[model samples]
Target: MKFNNKIVIVTGGARGIGASIVQHFINAGAIVHILDREFPDSFDVGGNDSVFRASGDVTNSDDVKSFIKGVVTKSGRIDSLVNNAGIIRDNMIWKMDESDFDAVIDVNLKGPWLMCKEIAPIMREQNNGRIVNIASRSWLGSAGQSNYSSSKGGIVSLTRVLALELGKNNITVNAVAPGLIDTPMTRSLPPEVFKKLENTIPTKKAGHPEDIAHAVAFLASDESKFINGQVIHVDGGKSIGANLH
Candidate 1:
């Protein structure tokens, strides 16, 4: 389970679940390349040399290309890619703005596509790679998350397609679908609403970012080579029909 000098790329790694995933790989001795819009003063790397931070927008093709090229030029290889960059523009379809929907789709879905497009060839050339996408349980269904849900649904499909396309090259593409995770984004919810959502989970409690990070790490590990085109729900049994009733 140790990466031991492996090169790992993580999008949206400045904070929250993405940050946790970055730290997990770093702790396992992997050199982590993090792409995020900003690293606030609070998010500290503590002078870690194994970490590379890139400030760029995932939705932009030029930015993605430059970032990947830089990583390749410096490291000469990319061992793994975690497409954890995403945005949530939750709202009922009628209430949602077109811009919000586009923004969500661009970041959550298109961003991953762009990243995969750029890295797929590198991995294929090396004949080895792992890709773990951070999808959402809401892809199953969420009342006020049409945009978010659609974007994640797209991720599920993308993972499967890539798995099929790259399996022969020793590349595996899989997804981690998280639910009720206690992140700053979830903490922004009103206490009552957050508690209500937490109660709906079969576990009756929220999960930590580490829970999802662990799943991502497992999927990115060599042991998961045979397992591809799959979506693992680290959702406290919520994907099995946990409900408010």
Candidate 2:
């Protein structure tokens, strides 16, 4: 019950890591609101009434504002905001389309900025809040992912800046960097490619969505109030430069 009665917002909670993060908050007793383009036929509540689904786009300022307003209108205040919406269009820079790069940056980096902008005042007035941005260990470096890597790196920087600006208000901002998580996206890779990537990881395995969810939950909970502006890598040591030999 670390987050009992708290009002929490998660972007892209329909599936993958976001869905797990939403469930984590729900289990901890937080009233979780999800902002996504569309929720599935049913937003899985597991018989819990603490889940709210708002259909919206994080890249749209108006949508972002409306989502926040709707959540606050219902909950009266916001406690934590997890910016988790992201997409990838991987290709080498030479072969990548300009639109693809823009798209990735807009959704992955700008989306979080919009959410933080809309929530900053509310959290500031409350004088207490938490913000957790989902970055990627690929932000450090990754081939054929120039746009994705750049977007996640921007997330890392944004986390630090927001923590500096919001720390005085007792609002801590942090990030979770996930590496090789076993989600639909990763599983969709060709068998040989997937195996090669898995073999490259120090653990020789891809992490589950719950692993990322747990790290995100910790940053959003009271236990991490003092740990701000940091990026926690839940990558099974893959971020430490895995040995391919």
Model 1 worst lDDT run, 10 consecutive residues: 39-48
| Tens-digit lDDT track of model 1 for 1-245 | 79999999999999999999999999999998988888888987656889999999999999999999989987889999999988887778999999999999999999999999999999999999999999999999999999999999999999999999999999999999999899878888889989999998999998999999999999999988899999999989899984766
Best by TM-score: 1
- Alpha-carbon deviation at 100 in model 2, angstroms: 0.5
lDDT (C-alpha) at residue 216 in model 1: 96
lDDT of 2 by residue, 167-187 (tens): 999999999999898886677
lDDT of each: 0.93, 0.92
RMSD of 2: 1.2
Query: What CA RMSD would you report for each candidate?
Result: 0.9, 1.2
Task: Give the lowest summed-lDDT range of ten residues in model 2.
Answer: 39-48
Clash tally for model 1: 0
